[model samples]
Target: MSELKAKLFQDLSDAVVDMDEEKTVETSHRVIDEGIDAYEAIEKGLAHGMDRVGELFDQEEYFIPEVLICSDAMYAGVEVLKPHLKGDEQGEKKKVVIGVIEGDTHDIGKNLVKIMLETSGFDVFDLGRDIPPQQFVDKAKEVGAHIIGLSTLMTTTMDGMREVVRILEETNLREQFKVIVGGGPISQSFADKIGADGYAANAADAVRLARKLVS
Candidate 1:
């Protein structure tokens, strides 16, 4: 990468972390003006910042309000770059149904996955926080979604992920959709225990996992 490109990407990342929406918007325009790849900016800059925000959140250095504001800044940058995406970036993409499991009000992880997946050409249906396990199945089936993503930051709500898988098995829809699980309290072992197809550690991995599952 060119030095200018690296610097701009860093600025975009910092803008999001700083919760500076105006700065993100300004940097996004500079990205377009300099012909930096929009997708690259979203991935390396905006998403990267969100990754940092997630870490801070895990450490309790940043709370829900801070994360939401950072997301706003990230979205502000994406809004400017979205329109300039190359034609190949536009397509009839796979569908994903995503939400935080029941008893868990934390939705930041789910939100980041939503943003990243949508930017990567997936049609994402965000069901928001504290969604019942059955609701995830219902929405996924309704949308003909190829993947179901379940998230929760609380250990108490982790069982909801297993319940979703169990429901799919009981309804004989287990084969119809790939179920992916992740959150602060979730791990690969937990995902396997719940019969989830995969576990993604972050937004970028979620996008990669979604692509591989659908492909």
Candidate 2:
């Protein structure tokens, strides 16, 4: 990329890392004005910044509030760029219903996954944190979703994931939707035990797993 383009992308990334919503909006407008590809701006700029934010959270350099603000900045940038995206970039996308399991108010991880899924062209229905297991299945059914994404950072709430699976099986909807689980306390064995289709380690991995399950 040209120097000017590179600098603008860097600015977009930095705005998110700094949690500067105004600057993120301004830089995103600059990206559109400068005729840069909106998709690249999202991937290389906003998403890149969120990746850093995720790392910070992992290292405890950034807490829940900071990460949430950072995501707001990134999302502000994304909104500015969304309308400018090419039609082909938004081809038919599989619908996914995602939310944190019951009793867990922590949604930083869920937010990250939503951003990644939305950016990757998946139709994501985010139910926010502290969601009940039945709600996930209900939303998936309501939206004709192909996937149900369950998340929780707490072990106590992990049972909610299994509960969702059980509910789906009881309702005879288990075969209709692929279930994917992830979070700090979730493991491949837990996912297997719950009869979920897959387990993702992070947002990017969730996107990949969603694609593979749908494919």
lDDT of 1 at 196: 95
Task: Estimate the TM-score of every prediction.
Answer: 0.66, 0.73
Error of 2 at 55 (Å): 2.7
Prediction RMSDs, each to the true structure = 4.6, 3.6
**Model 2 weakest 10-residue run by lDDT:** 100-109
In model 1, which residue pairs have backbone atoms overlapping below 3 Å? Answer: none
Best by TM-score: 2
Candidate 2 — which residues are off by over 4 angstroms?
91-94, 104-122, 129-135, 141-144, 152-160, 167-176, 182-189, 199-215
